[model samples]
Target: MTADRLQPVLAGVMLALVGFASSFAVVLAGLQAVGATSEQAASGLLALLIAQAVGVIWLSRRHRIPLVLAWSTPGAALLVSSGAVEGGWRAAVGAFLVVGALILLTALWPRLGDLIAAIPTPIAQAMLAGVLLSICVEPVRVLLDRPFLVAPILVVWVVLLRVAPKLAVPGAFVATLVVITGYLVDHGAPDLSLAPQVVWTEPTLNWQAVVGLAVPLYVVTMASQNVPGVAVLATFGYRVPWRESMTVTGLGTAAGAMAGGHAVNLAAITAAMAASPESHPDRDRRWIAAYTSGWAYLVLAAVSTALVGVVSAAPHGLVEVVAGLALLGTLGGALKGATESETGREAAVVTFVVAASGVAFGGVGAAFWALLAGLVVHGVLKLGRPSAPRM
Candidate 1:
């Protein structure tokens, strides 16, 4: 391949690793939080990553577009919260399948697609802000618990993000590794033996799980994860096929869920690296970067169980702080974009507030609720408004 082509491939690999490094722990914790044995969770995430790799490869190769897929970060948070309430991987799997079916239906049904499209962007933004708010909280809490280890790393991160544009996330990752290593040696961290082996779990599909878990999983993944993901692509001037992307994401999530992973979808943060000019000057070449990143994700997932134990040996607060700080930019941008419009601002705020309220009505998550509320408010506001001027 020419040097032009080679650059994106390399960039994608690096970006993908950074993306995984930031959020992989949350994925592990989500599974463990929801009653997955460390073994089952690892297997499931490996499955998710493998499926994601396949999807990313096929999609990028076929479309020649920079399409990157991964487990849903928002869905991970939802899994962490609802998994705690729902009990067992069975429920989580059922939810995953339901979400997949819904996405498939969205692809199949033009009317539903239009309806989903009708949702104002601001409301979607509001819900996104709400869903992300919870993730931001954990790192702050961790910082409070372990200031010595996390604070300096956070300082380095903020300064780097401001001072060195390209190196922000990667710099944070390096800083985290150094701090974690020092802490481990200084504190005499335990020697944990974890084998990087696959442990498959038999999937059980139940009505309660389907209704309670699956549908909600689909809603949250689509509403919270997929929507902004597409927006990011559009914002970056890539006219990617949304339906096709959703299909890949749906299938990937289904495959992952069957293997005990929560819900895999398009990655927002990782996508940024590939999408941004930092990855490569030519936008077309970024697809190679995304493809390489998918390969790396598969490798990491394959070894996730063993790696989890090794990583867990580090001071927990350090990882949390780094991940959070790395995400601060993305979160701030999402918040701003979600509230930029006058017409949709109020509904968006409602969406954010309702979603952030953490109320689960009829098995749906905060993302769905936020969007739902925002839609209703937006509609009411529209009807209440004087008619638009004729051209």
Candidate 2:
């Protein structure tokens, strides 16, 4: 292949590598937090990878745009914060299905999509920031608990942050693998099955989980991932097929939910990487990069269970160190988005504190409460303010 063609392939591989390595731990943690067992969590990861791969390849090829999809990172953080709801894991799966239905509903009813978009950016971002804070602190908590064991991963992460920002998290993950190997050498490796695996959970809807988990998950996925994805592509002069994109992601999420996957949505952070001039000078050809990424995800999916087995073998949820490292960047950006606007600062703080407190009532999670509390504060503060006089 010519260099023009080969460059996109490489870019595609790098995108998949960075995307998967940086956030797989978060996905695993999120699934487990909502009561998924190791097998189920691994299946969720597998389902998400396969769904994302199929979505990216199909959309990129059909639209001739570098349309990329990813498992919901912010949504995963929300799940970690939410923990298990009243009905446990099955309820969570049911909520996942509802989120997919909501996405699809929005696609068919533009007004529903508009209502979601109409939610003030500050409010949405503030809630997300609050939900992310707990997960972001995992590295520090892990370090304090076992200083020597976690230090090397952070060191590798810090070293790479200056040298290669994109590879920083992946580098930390590599350090984690080394640490895992050392432990395994000291105590012989556990028996691991290499055979393909899938675990299906029947959806059991519970109102509490729907309110606490589904609502927050759908909002986060849309606000943080799908919306930004559209903007990212637009910046590169590409118009995403909004309906088709939603249809694919919504259906994919629904299908994957039965197998423990939470949600899949449009790519945000990595969308720019694949569509930018860095991928290719010719705009028309950039889709090749995203197309190649789909294949890369399929390959990664094949090894998903094996990685899960190794990480599960590690002591004290050691992947938290790397997962925390991966999320710090996202937390910083979310905080900036939350606090940037002077008008919403008070409401944002209220939301942040409530979410960080991890409070729940009536079996609902803090994420839903945080958003509601912020809105109430935001609205109350606005009640008597002088309106812009006939601007």
Candidate 3:
């Protein structure tokens, strides 16, 4: 292949690896938090990878755009903090199905899309920034808790950020690998099979799970994942067909739920990697990067069991530190977006504080509450003022 083709391919692979290495542990922890066993968690990872691979390939081809798909990281974090649901993992799967159906319905109905779009951009960004705030602090916490193990990673990440900003997180990831390898060598490799497994669980929908998991999952996936995903594509001049992409991802989420995975949607950070001009000089050819990433996800799926084992074996807080480092840039961007406008500044700050508070009511997570609080504050403050004329 010519260099033109090879560059996109390389970019695709880089994005895939970065995406996987950064958050696979969070995915596992989220599954376990919702009551999944080790076997079930592996299956969930496999299912998510396969579903996203299909979605990415199909959407990239259909739209002829570098449309990347990902399982919702914020949703997973919500799950992690959601505690166990009433019906256990089955109910969680049911919630996943419900979330997927909602996304699909939104895609099929323009009104639903409009309703979500009606959410103020600053509020959404604030909520996302808040959701990410906890995890983004892990590197610092880890540094204080296990300085010997984490200091090198921070040093490498900082050095790369100053000299090669694009590779900063990837460098931290490399440092993590080195640290993990040493620890594993000292403690003995985990006994894990190389082959991937698929464990199917029946869905059980309960009001508790639906209200708690489903609603929050849908809101965060839409506000934090899909919205920013579209923005990333738009940043590179790609006009996203939002509805079609939602439909594909929603379907993928539903399919993955049967195998224990959570919601899959348009990717935000990784999508930028694939859609960026650096992926391909010819804008029209960047779709190749997404396609390549899809295939790479499939390859990762084939080794899902081993990947889970490696992450699962790592010391407590280590994986989170790496994830925190990987997401630092995203957190920075979200914060900037959240506070950029003076009109919504107060509402945005309210949203950020509420979300970061991690308050849960009626089993629902803080992200939903944050958005609600922001909207209320925004509305009340704007009550006596003239509404900005609708465009």
**Candidate lDDT (C-alpha), each:** 0.69, 0.91, 0.86
- Per-residue alpha-carbon lDDT of candidate 1 for residues 1-391, written as tens digits (9 for 90 to 100): 9877778878877876777766776676667656787567777767777878888888878887777787876666556545444436766666667777677677677466566656565665566567667666766798778878777777776787689865666676667777877877888877654555566556666565665456545655666566667778778888768778767766776666667777767767677778888778877777778878878776776667666665567765554455555446646866887887776788888888886787766655455556667888888988999997999
Question: Which stretches in model 2 have alpha-carbon errors above 4 Å?
Answer: none
lDDT-best of 2 and 3: 2
lDDT of 2 at 195: 51
Clashes of each: 5, 0, 0
The pairs that clash in candidate 1 are 8-289, 12-289, 95-213, 95-214, 99-218
Candidate 1: give its CA RMSD in angstroms: 3.5
Tell me model 1's lDDT, rounded to 2 decimals: 0.69
Report the backbone clash tally of model 2. 0
lDDT of 3 by residue, 258-325 (tens): 89999899998899988888899899999999999999999989988976777678788887787677
List the candidates' TM-scores in order: 0.83, 0.98, 0.90
Ranking by lDDT: 2, 3, 1
Error of 2 at 316 (Å): 1.2
C-alpha-based local distance difference test score of model 2: 0.91
Alpha-carbon shift of residue 168 in model 3 (angstroms) = 2.3
| Model 3: ten consecutive residues of lowest lDDT | 322-331
- The order of the candidates by TM-score, greatest first, is 2, 3, 1
What tens-digit string does per-residue lDDT give for candidate 2 at 1-391?
9898899999999999989999999999999999999899999999999999999999999999999999999999899989989998999999999999999997888787787888777788888888888888888998988888799988989999999988999999989999998999999999976654899999998899999999999999998999899999999999999999999999999999999899999998789999998888999999999999999999999999999999988988587777778888888888888899898788888888888889999999999999899889999988957888785
Top candidate by TM-score: 2
